[model samples]
Target chain A: MSESDLEEMFTLAVSVAKEAGQIIRDAFDKEKEVDTKLSAADLVTESDQAVEKIVNTRIMEKFPTHRFIGEETTSESGEKHELTDDPTWIIDPIDGTTNFVNRIQEVSFSLGIMVNKKTVIGVVYAPIKDEMFTARLGKGAYLNGMKLQASKITDLKQAVIITEGGSSRDAKEVEDKVKNIHALITHTRGIRAYGSAAVNLCHVAAGRGQGYVEYGIHIWDFIAGALIAKEAGAVVLDPTGCDLDPLRRRILCACSPEVAKGLSQILTHLDMGCD
Target chain B: MSESDLEEMFTLAVSVAKEAGQIIRDAFDKEKEVDTKLSAADLVTESDQAVEKIVNTRIMEKFPTHRFIGEETTSESGEKHELTDDPTWIIDPIDGTTNFVNRIQEVSFSLGIMVNKKTVIGVVYAPIKDEMFTARLGKGAYLNGMKLQASKITDLKQAVIITEGGSSRDAKEVEDKVKNIHALITHTRGIRAYGSAAVNLCHVAAGRGQGYVEYGIHIWDFIAGALIAKEAGAVVLDPTGCDLDPLRRRILCACSPEVAKGLSQILTHLDMGCD
Candidate 1:
């Protein structure tokens, strides 16, 4: 894609994020029609579907030939998304739907654009908190227009890690994740869980925390925030210290490589398989 | 104390919190001189001591006869506070010092006034986030002047819980807390950790999460938040379902009694001895 083409898409992505954020903000305090998928912790609200539909429509209308992959669409189809060399827009319209349903303030809309199977642009907007994080592949990330930079802390002992108890109810998966959580607490200064994968990544980008690691998330849950974090000079990788596989159901992000490596060694990495 | 006295103290408490908040916000993004108290995870920054000193001086100036207990003072003196029937003000000048040092947004100034050994006024101010939570005995809680209420969820399986990996690095303490965390993740819809006991309690009061439980916190850490949660119609109790002993160093807060009971049944309660 040319620079002008990417700029146009980025503009569209930001505008669509604002629209989705408005929907999320307006419905944040209202009674939500919430449904479950996979497990009780896995939530989908009316706002999720509504925003996804509106965003998907707007994307297709402007870039008719562009491929689109969205959390709701994939869940509805019950199929794996096949990536291609062509420009593709990936979205998790409401990244923290459970937070939205529970009236927590970490909810956001995540969007990432990829060409040649590599991310080129990213945007994440948390409507309740009024934070809009944006990034281009070469340009630095920004939070509400202020440039963001990850923390300079390099030691695991000085780091505060963000993690999650994902919606997976599988006993073994839960146990493995629990082991990782224990390791995090034992090794780091502390651990925090904000219940949103996208926001967790953004937190690392904004230097709110030193690192974030999670298992059992879809590509849409982190694709955008991964780019944003990377643009802010953070390291994004698989939990095993390898390059992040977007389709893989896990990620390890840190402000520096030493902390990333430290996290990888300590975590009981769960092989959650691929998308 | 009379109603007029309580009101006067409440005014002073709120004002002191704002001043402490100003101190916190000014130093939040700056380089911090961090120190460790109990362990590597137990952090104390210069801002913590500075805020505590300022708040203590302000409180004593306004109410010279009232007794005062603060986190920094207790830590510095290495002495336990004695709860009494006289008017007392308890403060955690920087409730989440670790977060403050790490530039996380969960840090706050927490203050509570107790008369006849009963709390009458509570205030928590998160300077970075600009959330002012306040409550008075027999009065409802408010966040930034808007009335607050806990969630109505009653079932553990349908609820989200807030917890923490506290600053304790004791091996047994870590194991026991991790076990409780496993139980929480197994039973609840989800779990979140924002790294601040006062903010965690206020989260439940504000309906951000259905419940919050933690072991090994002092009266200063939770005194104000406990009252805020109670005033917002939440159940504040010991982890074992008994009355909350302000000095007990453990607390369990839930939006409803049923959820509190359910959490109590599932938790592997830790007997973190009194302050």
Candidate 2:
């Protein structure tokens, strides 16, 4: 895509995020014990679907031949993503669904535009906290119009790492994650769990913490935030120190290469498989 | 103490919190990985001591007969507190010290007043977040003057719980806390850790999450927030299902009695000695 096209897409992405954020904000206020009833599950799905459909339609209308992928759409159709060298818009209508359902303030709407299988524009809007993080492929990141830079801590023991107990109940998955948590606490100054992959990446990018790692997240959950973090001078890597495979369902991000390598060494890398 | 006296004390407490918050906010921005150097340790301790001395002096100037207890004073003097029937002011110059050193956004200044051993006024100010949480004995809690209330969820399965790994790195203590974390993930919808006991309680008060429980925290870290959570219609208790002892170093707070009981029933309670 041309620079003008990228800028236009970025503008649309930001506007679409605000619209999705409004729906998320409204639904967040209404979330409750409805998590117990299967029928009432639509309470969240309804808003998710509404946002996804609107976003898909907007993308189709603006760029007639562009591809679109969304969390709600993928879940609804159970279709595998077809990433190609085409202009594709990937979005997570609501990244922290549990936080949304629980009324926590870390929820966000994340959008990333990938062309030639490389992200060109990334945006992660945390509406409740009013933090709009944005970045272009090589440009630096920004939060609410201010430039962002990751903390310059290179020592792992001096770092405060952000992580999560993701919503997987598989016994082995739970055990592996718990082991990683133990390692994080034992090695670092502390461990924090904000319960959202996108928000966690944003926190690292904003210098709120030095590093963040997680297992069992989707491409739609961290793709945009990963770009933002990278643009903020942070390293985004696979947990095993390999190149980041977005479909791999795990990520490790840190302010410096040393911290990133240290984290990868300590973590019991879980193979959560590809998207 | 008379109602008028309580009101005056509450006013002083809030004003003192703000003054202390200014210092904390300024210091938080300059915080770094100073944990590695004994000299750099003074970076945080200086702010803590300055805030404590200023608050102590103000209390003495206004209410000479009132007793005072503070985290910095206790740590400096290495003396046990002398709790009595006399009206006493308890304060933590800076809660979440780990977060403070790491430049995370969970640090706060907490103050609570107890007369005849019963808390009458409470205030917790998170400077970085600019959240002022306050409460009186019977009146409801408020966050920045907006009325606050905990979530109304009763079932553990539908609730999201807030907790922390804390600063303790003892082998057994770490093991116990990790065990409780595992149980929390298995039973609740999710778990969140914001890294500050005071902020965690305020979060519960604002209906941001359903419950918050932590061990190995001092009274100054929780007295104010406990009152805030209680005034917001939440249940505050000892982890073992007893009335909360202010001097105890552990706390368990839930939005409902049912949720509290459910949480108490499934965990390895740690005995982090009293104040």
- Write candidate 1's Cα lDDT for B18-77 as tens digits: 999999999999998888998988989888899989888888898899899989889989
Q: Any runs in candidate 2 off by more than 4 Å, and if so which?
A: A31-44, B31-44
Worst 10 residues of 1 chain B by lDDT: B1-10
Interface RMSD of 1: 0.5
lDDT of 1: 0.94
Q: What tens digits encode model 1's per-residue C-alpha lDDT throughout A34-93?
A: 899999889898888999999999999999999999999889899977889999999999
Residue B185's C-alpha lDDT in candidate 1? 94
Index of the highest-lDDT prediction: 1
For every prediction, compared with the true complex, DockQ reads: 0.91, 0.58
lDDT of each: 0.94, 0.87
Q: After superposition, how far is residue A64 of candidate 2 from its true place, in Å?
A: 2.0
- Candidate 2 per-residue lDDT, tens place, B62-94, comes to 999999999877876767666799999999998
